[model samples]
Target chain A: MGEIWPLFPAAIFLSFFFLLVLIELFTISLTKTNVFPTLEPAVEILKNGEFHNALLNTLAFVAIGTPLELFAGLFAALLVYNSYWGKSFVRTIFVIPFAFPGLVIATLLFILFDSQGGFANHLFQGQYWLFPKIIDHDVAWRGSKYLALSVSMLGKVWRDMPISMLIILSGLNSIEPELIDAAKTMGAGFRVRLQRIILPLIFPAMTTVLLLRSVEMWKEFIFPYILAGNYPLLGTLIEKLYGFGSDPGEAAVVALVLVGLTILTLVVIVEITGRIKRVLVNSGVNSK
Target chain B: MSYIDRDEIGKRIVWAICVIVMIIGIIAPIYLLIKYSISDPSTMNTGGRPIPLWPNRPTFDIFLYLFRDREFWGVVSNSAIIATLTVLLTSLLSIPAGYVLARYNFPLKRFFLILLISVRLFPDISSVIPIATFFVRANLHSSFISVVLAHTLLSLPYVIFMATTAFEFVPKDIEEQARVIGANRVTIFTRILVPMVFPSLIAGAIYTFLLSWDEFIFAHFLLDTGGQIQTLTLYLNKNLSFSPPQNVLAAISVCLSVPVMVFTFVVQRYMVSGVVSGAVK
Candidate 1:
């Protein structure tokens, strides 16, 4: 027992890894239906197939969301890069949404878009009237799968774009003024200077933020759970399996898929961003 | 100053428009939340426009209701306790581990760093079932300690990840100087190393605090009984039934967001740099 005491921490670490592996095995082996009959029919639900779909959804979401955020963020950062009157305040306001809890952000959208008394209906019709007679006639936001997905995307963008902006802003700050001055001396215009200098130098920072944000958006649960309602994002699918009560087999299957897709996404990001030589050269030029 | 420079003005104008659109898109909903929180509940329920640009019949009733409600206070206290404890415990475990990772040449060090980063990327949902099961078996569900431990799991990796950078930034020469001055390793760490890395530590603490305070999944999954261990987010989710008074809910949301907002505002300058530094390799 005394000798075993020394091995306790290692044992705990091993157990944690064991639990993760066990979840992966269960997720891969079981039929989704047999694992979670209440959530979905066992006959049509192939664990392997659903796993693939979730992987696809995760990849698609990341692919769509990350570049979108980066472009938007970089544009905003460049716009605000040169100090202007009230720029600090503008930066502060931009960051407010990020400070609000994800659940609050989701609920705010839900309140704004939920087919009943939603602000979207009012805005679309250009009326300030509350409880407009036309709200019920509008399609429910959560009822339509595509609309639900769009709203999820919008909510996520609103919350996360500021994060990307902040990252790019710092990267912008680190670029030395002499480079800009040298470019201006060379008769390069604004677009040329940006394309030739700023873009290359900031690419590494941009890629890092992109990878982080992609991982975050892929794993996101709260916004989709609230805004998407019953639409089956990977996060929600896992939740449904767990909610069905003691369906460890199916839940494990979902978990394994989640982990595998996350690793794949990470690997892809590393590969794409691995070519840092161009960025390093640009950074060196700016430093000099 | 010349006609040729008019192009610059045009560019600035375009930039202004873009910035305004981005700000409006991000800030409008949050502004509406604040507006709704202050709007009269009666006006809200009566289907009135309720002053879109300004508060009409603004009242402190919502804030009063939140303060007076036992459930609200209970959840706030629970959130505070859990968040604070999670930050404390996460730092305790992570700082030493981070120091080791930053300074040591241990075997599997690179692998461990990769593992930590990957774990951060792994979705919380993936581990929910097994962790939940473990909690149930241990009979720790709905307990404050359980939630704190759960939050620690979510927070520890980031703390270590951030702190490693923070520790690495402290110049080795300074530590060597301290040692030459007869300061012990512990003294050098507390007196020199900690003060230098204080900003990163604070940023890490704030991040962990916010993460725990806003966490909903584990709190929802683990806490079953009312009044047992309801964090603020859990309370908000639980109260999101049909016809929850918008003003009251908004008030609660405002209350929940204020600390983070204030923290961000206070550290506004350092926060951005700190985050970018920690995250962007």
Candidate 2:
């Protein structure tokens, strides 16, 4: 007993994890919803290639959305890098969305894009009136899976872009003014200076932002759940596994898959990036 | 050349565009939410675009309704109680823990540090099931204590991270000076270290409070019995989902976010420096 006392903390931690798994199982039974209905059915779904399709959709969303957001953030940062009038206010305004809870943003978007009498409809039909034909048409943003996914992406971009912006802003701040000055003296334009100098110097920060945002987007739940409604991302799927009326076994499988995927991605990114960084540093040193 | 003047004008124009985009993307949406809160409930169902810039008839009926509702007050109290307790418990545990980690070279310190960082990185979904079940088995489910415990899990990591950074910045020479005067460890900690890091500690405390205040997942899952331990976020979610009148729901959301905004406004300076110091350093 005395000898085993040291293992108490470990035991407690394991028990806590076990308890979580148990609750997950209970919720699955309680929910009665299944991610993979049966082993055979899941196999059939895989064979039918819906699983592959879903996987592709998830990957595509991450691939496209992540880079777009990162670029948008960088662009915004660069636009606001110089100390200008109202810069602080702009920064504060941009960060407000981040501070507001995800749930609120999701709900607000829902209100704005509702098919009937929504702001989108009003805008299309009113002042601009360019899309008159489209304005008359009932566009069910929430009903269509594609539309739902798009809204989810938009919400994520809105919430997450600021994070990247903050990161890039800090990175921009760290870059030496001499480099920019030298480039300008050599008759380089703003675009030339940005492409050649700013981008390379901020690559490390960009990598960090990319990694963090990707991981965050992968695990994001509430916004996607609320916005996409029926459409399930991996996060939403895991959530459903734990939600009432979910099938525990299938949910467990999904949860395990998610954990595995996340670990795999993190490992791959870290290893690849670490190697690349080492190579770059070594090459620079050898050149010097 | 005049081309350079044109380029500067272009840059200013782009900056203006960026500011406008930000206002539309970030400010307008929040403004709409606030606007919806004051709009009459009757107008919500009419399905007009509800020009949020200025409502035709603005009223505080929704706010009045929310304030008058006992359940709303209950949720507010629950949120306050839980956030306060979480802040207190987290600060108490994390300050000393962070101090030890920062100042001392304990055995397995690196491993512990790794564990802390790993826990912070672990997605909340991975731990939610186990944490919830543990609470249930312990007969702490759906209670304020369980909620506080859950919040502590979320808040502790940040607290420790922030507090440790603060602790590290406290001059070691001061502690040595205290020791030379025959001051005990406790005295050194309370009198010397505490005062030095008081601002940072307060900043951390405020952050923890905000975290607990905003945390929804565990609170939503753990608190089953309605009105027993419903937080502001939970209450807002419940009301939002239950098809409460849009104005009322919006009002509740506004109320819910008000505290966070106020807190941010109050602690923005301290938080900015604290986060920059701890994270960017």
Candidate 3:
């Protein structure tokens, strides 16, 4: 104990702030509507139509964005899995999107998807001779709720691709070359090798990607805040409640809900992945 | 007879397509951003013509304008000050704690470790209001002190993790040798252990600096009332809310991002591990 006094500083700093935040969140949220403790704040926010919409939007964001991000990362890792000339340079380039701040990426998307004369709109309208016209008129990227949220998801997924890529790339690199070589020697096709060997081996990395990316998607605030101001995901909803609505109680309630959803998603992912692993193992035994 | 392996040909073809797609998908947006920054009015507001891929007359007017702007410089300096202070604060708190954790087997060590990592589980957006409210109530809101503290809290876990790994890498024999030479604990910690772990600590510091520099949610809430304090992120957000000219926005975005981009390339190796560590453990 005498020798461990050095740990006190960091321990106190973290624990102090940690308790302060939890206490503050709970106190304000419960005491908002009554002098005594109550669940009114939670009830009020939960019953609101806006909260429901935001909840659904957040669910959709996590559902679509997490899997898409994992696939994007897996795609990138597979692309560079084989050694080639300029491989290091290509890998560095893949990280460029993530190197930029989230806010910067969202702002760039805002400009590019600007309803009128934006580059994307111009391209789709066939202003460029290199590609045929896909749409005759300009499409408003943020004109509707779906379109707005889609733009936000696009920005979120684009900016975060590198995180998943790095995780999965490391996973891919861990695969012993001898395994692949043996598969090739046995006349296993590329598709079979991928389906049977590589995919199963990289399952852990994919699980990591899913876990981390889902949490990120749930807490995504900047993209939707910037790109789809009219539409509120649960994250941006917290900002809106406190910033514009000036209701800290409601905001705290939403924040708590966001945290709950994140934990739930994590649990569900773990269980699902565990079940799949068991099924895969059982099938392999049956086939043998 | 001419025969080719279809699998070999198929792999090459797919790889080629992927390389092209990856290059264009990543590079095109960045190109547009730069073009927008330097673009002249005619190129931006073509009024109905297809906007040219390249700017009609590229100029440095926006960059020059920003360089000469006092407010822009203020925001830049504010971000620098807060980020520097965060790195300092986080290092001071994390190094001793990390060293202790790496070397000692204290009671409740497992609990402390879990507590440290789980501190990061709270979403920044959710946590910001409470932190901001506390600061405001304490009359520290809008001050650099509160923002720096919040940033340190946010980045401490990663730095601590990095520092622990760093200290663990320094063999225990060196410390034992120092003790045998009659050196005390403090002397060995400062003269031997710290020096050996200095490079990794610097890596941790760089990571902390970037985290603080790129932080927004906490800063936004803490500095919300004080119109005087603006980080680069807030400056960009404010400009965007009011519909600034495309070039000015792009220039500001470029300025804000250049430091992060530069450090990223330099510390890419450390960053890969730092990123994974933050998520996995």
Candidate 4:
């Protein structure tokens, strides 16, 4: 027992709060307006149109945002992977995004994407001479649900890209340089080395990024709440229900669903990544 | 040109372009933020004239306005008070727990560690409702006490994780020597073990401070109804709802962000380890 006294405070504090949260969450979800325990809140939420919309919107957000983050991260990692002048400088720049508060980033995106003469609209509408006209009109970024959600996803991806980059960069650093040099000496080109050697080696890092980023996307609130308030994700829906709608039962239900989706994403990613890694390893051995 | 020379040149060009794009992507937004913060009314309200890339007449009037505003100071003080309390409480709870976890071998140690870390994996939004509900029922909602406790709960795991690593990094021989020298466990812990891990513990404390400072969901939920107290995050969110002038929002955002950004750059070396520790483990 090594003197159980030291760990007691933190253990009790954590467990008490966690158990309280779990019990309260379920308790609120199963009841409405001081009614006895019932499934009405969950049932009603499941049958609501807004809930469905938020669910579908959240799925789209995750589907688009997660992979976008992976690609953005992978791009940044590969950019700084090779030895180059000012490598640390470039790495610092990539990390700067993560340094900013998410609220600040969302606010900045709000300013730049504002409907009336926003920077993005000006640039895309060909007001800026350096860039060709991508659009004929100043686009109201939050004009439609899809547009609003897209902007939210863009902000989310931009803010979180650094986390993915750092994770992938650490994975890249763990690859021994000699392995790549050996491949090159054996007449393997960049493409071949990337596909065969580098990709499989960093698959776990990519998987980690995917799993973490998807969970993040599923629970994303600030960006959507700020940039796309008209449309709701599961995260923002919880806020709307609890704060404005005054429906704690329904809010708790949505919160539970968000937690469920996060766990489900975690499981699905782990299983798929595990299977894929096995296949990749077996194929690599067979090919050799 | 030789084949190698041509290939090298092509690669350099691509690398330069990519680097330029990345730099622009990161810097442009920040520049726009600063620009808006400094922009005069003429620059912001141009009557549909395309806003200049540079503000026509930049000024720090909004910054001065915020500095002079009592309400802004109140919000700033609230955020500072909450963040400081969270750091103190989280560190106090976590340091000893982390020390024990680092040094002692006990039954169910793995179980305890997972229990601590798994608490982090729960979605903050999902967890906040129940917590907020509890606070309201206890008549503690909107008080500094509830917000500090909530923020401490949010950051306790990371501090514990960081503190454990900090304590683990200290060589065991020093502790053993102290014990052999007739020093009590408390004396050795306060005198030897803690001093050795002080730097890393400070890092853990800073991390806790940042988490509490940047926290929003709990602060917003707990304090929204009371309307008596507001943190910087809630202030910004409330201002955003009323569609305040962009310059004011930018200035407030700058105030809220500068400390975090400065600390991040100053402690850039510890960042990777800290980030990886929280995420991967």
Deviation (Å) of B183 in candidate 1: 4.4
State every prediction's TM-score relative to the real structure: 0.83, 0.86, 0.96, 0.97
Per-residue lDDT of model 1, residues A83-139, tens digit only: 456787777777677888888887777777757555576565446544345433456
Worst 10 residues of 3 chain B by lDDT: B272-281
Order the candidate numbers by lDDT, best to worst.
4, 3, 1, 2
**Which clashing pairs does model 4 show?**
none
Model 3, backbone clash pairs (residues 3+ apart or across chains), number? 0
TM-scores of chain A in all candidate models: 0.77, 0.77, 0.97, 0.97
Task: Tell me how each candidate scores on DockQ against the true complex.
Answer: 0.35, 0.34, 0.71, 0.71
Q: Tens digit of lDDT per residue, candidate 4, span B17-100? A: 998998898888899999999999888887766788788988999999999999999999999999999988998899999999
Instruction: Tell me what fraction of the real C-alpha contacts between chains A and B each candidate also makes.
Output: 0.42, 0.26, 0.69, 0.72
Candidate 1's C-alpha runs over 4 A off are: A1-60, A128-139, A269-288, B46-51, B171-183, B224-227, B268-281
Q: How is the predicted docking of candidate 2 categorized under the CAPRI scheme?
A: acceptable
Q: Please provide, for model 4 over A120-224, each residue's C-alpha lDDT reduced to its tens digit, 9 standing for 90 to 100.
A: 887887777688889888788998898899988888898889999999999999999999999989988778999998989999999999999998999899999
The Cα RMSD across the true interface for model 3 is: 1.1
lDDT (10s digit) by residue, model 2, range A193-270: 876678778878888887887777666677767767577776666556456634344444454555667777778777
Better of 2 and 4 by DockQ: 4
Ranking by DockQ: 4, 3, 1, 2
